[model samples]
Target: MSQSTAAGDAVQAMMRAVVVTRPGGLGALEIKEVPVPVRERGWVRIRVKAFGVNESEVTTRKGESDPEVTYPRVPGIEGVGVVDEADEDSGLRPGQQVATMMGGMGRTYDGAYAQYVSVPAAQVIPFETGLPWDVVGALPEMFQTAYGSLTTGLDLRAGQTLLIRGGTSTVGLSAATLAKDLGATVLSTTRSPDRTGELRDAGVDHPLTDNGTVADQVRELMPDGVDAALELVGCSVLADTLRTVRRHGTVCFTGALAGQWSINDFTPFMIPVGVRLTSYAGEAADLPADVFARQLEAVAEGRLRVPVAKVHHGLEQVQDAQDDVESGTAPGKHVVVLDD
Candidate 1:
């Protein structure tokens, strides 16, 4: 409508989308024809090519997400696609490759679970890559969280020792790959002994089994404790994770993979004396354009991996993809690709 080259004028007004009528089990997800979202002044409409199925969406479907999530909503926090429409001043042209995530998406408003999504211009990240749609879709939220946690949350540096508490998760695997590339020694944990090999293949230096607690094993590997630790298992194991860090080392909490959000009795003593505690819940801008482009190039050139566990073909497989993610049957990112 704003004279963008890729405006959707020739496309139909109605498109198929997976809608959650209300918070419930997998049965709550239903495929229905919904009007394509209209482009607003400060927003761009994306013809979604692919999107990753994340645990947060699973929580949204179960009605366990933050109070911001409402019924009959589309559930997707991250997507990669071409712009269908944009205002002339938005710096985004129609058909420009882009990615969007985490500015109240899928919760406060409808999100990428549809054929098209309208998102604020500020939250959209533009990039150029030759990677496939499924691979690119898996990168946005997973890579953003991992990159932000390492650089912003931990200030991780080369030659340092880093520990991932929930090593088998998509973010955990992403962090391990990035940390390894940064020349850090990675010690990652997994509850399943079978998945330790997966961590090793992801360039992890040490793969520790997580039987609820991993501090003892971590200390055994690094007598002085790791230089930094990433807490993805959540508050339930935050105290033990703190013990895995050396004096003055940092621990950054970024995910709640164990589904535990808060500790009943939190206290200052729960943290080590000289260790710093931080958390990362960042937006799209936290992952700079240069960083995103470089990572995409790395993946394209085979210097890095996307760690995609599976790729579902269309909206019909959305439930199956969510089920695989919720069940943890796969240890990496699950993506849904919408083919024309």
Candidate 2:
């Protein structure tokens, strides 16, 4: 890590950042000192402490543009930091701790891969959890995504049934936690045979492995079929997910690791069955302040358990982190620690 220069040193204006020169693999990333972003009116500058890696952001760095990607960018989507500077109008102040995130962070702007970043003041969410930076870093994207899909996208009711694909993943697990807390019956899928029991321990009542046909397994569990399906694995099992859902049921597609498959059987079949296929992309960047505060409270109080599989050192090691996330070695969240 580069040391900060003396007070009033113009050199301190620059910060060290990890840059993706090209998108082949981990070897393509490099660390270099660059100009620190200056705070502008209505924006806040944060000194990044830790950042979380998401599969979509990794795919974005590798040149996926579902959210649109630009080259030579930083590679972290969610992170925690202390405010370096704040815009007065936003009611945020310097030295305040906060978390920030949105769609394709590193791909869109100079992102959390750098020591410093400037984002709209409104986009920053304040937390008083005092949780380790890694866990805090992992929360925003997964939490917001889960919260939005459950409450907004699917309009999940208290007694509805939810089936989550990739149940072992961070998003999958987080959604399970939220649904359970909301009084829903949670059924989930795990590719790993060993984790099926673990999912039950984590609040998912019915867990299935990829080997079994999802539709049949779910039917055996809920003969009436599920009210909703959270599609994190994408096309490979989308058809099966669609089949397991009840008439007028909804399936929200949030991730696409299993290859984007066409819903060929959905044309006439979906209408007759009353199944709804909804592809949820982005979320409201700014969560309701009270809900976000409660989320942080859940993390601190242990109601929300965020599992971190690995934490690498700084921006330079981000490629390795990305590799771990992509290879499925990360059992939970993969993070990049920017500070000691």
Best by TM-score: 1
lDDT of 1 at 169: 91
147-181 per-residue lDDT for model 1 (tens digits): 99999999999999999999989999999999998
lDDT of each: 0.92, 0.79
- Could you tell me the TM-score of candidate 2? 0.90
Tens digit per residue, CA lDDT, model 2, 20-71: 7767566667888888877778878898998888886667666764546777
Residue 50 alpha-carbon offset, candidate 2, angstroms: 0.8
**CA displacement after TM-score superposition, residue 269 of candidate 1 (Å):** 1.0
